[model samples]
Target: MNGIDIHNYVDCNDMFRAAANFFAACCRCAVAEKGVFNVAISGGSTPDGLFEELVKMKDSLPLEAIQWFWVDERCVKPDAPESNYGRAAKKLLNRLQLQLDNVHRIEAEKPEAAEKYEKIIRTLLPLNKKGLPVFDLVLLGMGPDGHTASLFPEKFNDLPGDKIVLKVPEPEHILPAVPRITLSMQAINSALEKVFLVTGNNKMELLKVIKNGQGNHYPAAGIFQAAWFVCCKPGSQD
Candidate 1:
C-alpha cells in the first residue's frame, strides 16, 4: 500500500477486536495528554460490530473523558432507522457513561445542521494553524463502491476540499438514499489519526485498487494517512 498501513484479519470479529484495541489505546493516550479525547465516528455495518466490541472495553477506555462526534449523518430524525446518530447511540453511547455535552450528534434533519456542526467544532475542538478543527481520531468505514463518510464516488469532484462540513445531496447509487451532512476532506485529514474499518471479500477488488494507489477516483482514496483494518478469507490478498 502506498500510503495506507494494512492490517489483515481472518474474520470480522478479530478485526473488530484490533480496531477496538486501537480505539481504546488512542482514547487513553489522548486523555492522558489532554483532558479529553475527541473522536469522530462513521456509521455502517462494519462499525456496528466495533461499537459492540468497544462496549466490552468500557472499563478500560476513558469513556467519560472522550468526546464523540459523527463523521456524517443522513437527513433523518434522530430516532429514524436511517439515522447514524441513532445507530451509534444504541450501539455505543447508551452503553457507556459519557458526558451529555460530549456527544455531538449531527442533527441532520435541520436545514442548518451543517453550519451548526461546523460552528460547534470550531467552538469545542482545538484548531490547527489552517483553522481546521484537529480531532484526536477520525474513524471511518468504506462502502463497497469506495465511498467514505457521505462522500460518494459520483460526488467526489463536487466536494469542497477546504470546507469543514458539507451538505451532501441524496445518493442515487447507495442505500438509505437520503441527503446527508458530512465532515469535509479538509476536516477529516486534519485529524491526528485516520482509520478505516473494511471487511468482507466483496471489497477485495476495491481494496486492491486503493492499496496500489490507483483509486484516485474513489472518495476513500482521498483520505490522507489512512490505515485500513480489513478482514476477509485467508489468502484473499493474493
Candidate 2:
C-alpha cells in the first residue's frame, strides 16, 4: 500500500511514448546483463496504445531478446476478438521480426488452463536457489473498478496462495466468454520492474483513493513496487 511513482500525461499518446521508451530501456538492460528479457503484459485500452507505439518502434526496439507473456488473459481462442493475446498479436507481435518461440501465450482453451499455463511459465522462468521464477518487467492496467490482472476487490480473499497462475472465476456480466488466468501477486512482485498505464476521467477518483491508501480491498492496491502513469485530460489531478 505504499505510494507508487506517479507519472501524469496530458494524453494517451504521450503515455504510449513514455511506455514504449521504458520497455526499450528494460529490454536493453536485460539483454546486456542476462541476454533475455521476460515481460508480462496486461490487456486493456491503454495497453493497446502502447502496443501500437511499440509496433512503430519495432526496428529500434530490441525485439529479439524479449520474451512476451500476459499478466492475464481471457479464456478464448487465439483468433477471438476478445482474446488479449490476439489483440497483442495483431498490434505488435505480428508486426515484429521476433521469433514465435519468444511469445509464450497463455493456453486459454486447455482443460485446467490455469494450471497448464503455470507449468509453462515455470519452465520458461529462471529458477533461483529456492526455485522461483524471476521476471524482468511486468506491465499492468487498472480498471475503473480498481482491478488489475483479473484480480478484483471482491476477489482479494482468493489471492493468498503461492501459485504462480490463478484461475479467476468469471464476473457476472463481463465481456469475456469464459474464466480468466492471471499471474498471482507473488509472481508479479518478483519482477525487477513493474509499470501501470491508466487513463480516462472515470478512474481519477479511484486513483486518488488508492494513492491515499484508503482502498486496500482493491487488487490494484497489491501493486506496491510499480510505477504508474495516469493519462488524463488537461488539468486532471495526479
Among these predictions, the greatest lDDT belongs to 1
How do the residues 1-238 of candidate 2 rate in per-residue lDDT, one tens digit apiece? 5658889988789888998899889999899998889999987666888988888888876677889999998888888888888888877788785698999989877768888888888898886554556789999988877888988766668665778888887855456646888898878878888899988878988888888899788789888878998888967553
**Model 1, span 1-238: residue lDDT tens:** 4478989988889999999899988888999999899999998767988999999988888677998999999999999999899989888898896779889999999999999999999999999999999999999989888899999999879878778999999997998989999999889999999999988788988999988989998889989888899988866653
Residue 178 C-alpha lDDT in model 2: 68
* Residue runs of model 1 more than 4 Å from their true location after superposition: 234-238
What clash pairs does model 1 have?
none
Off by over 4 Å in 2: 128-131, 235-238
Model 1 residue 80 CA deviation in Å: 0.3
Error of 1 at 13 (Å): 1.0
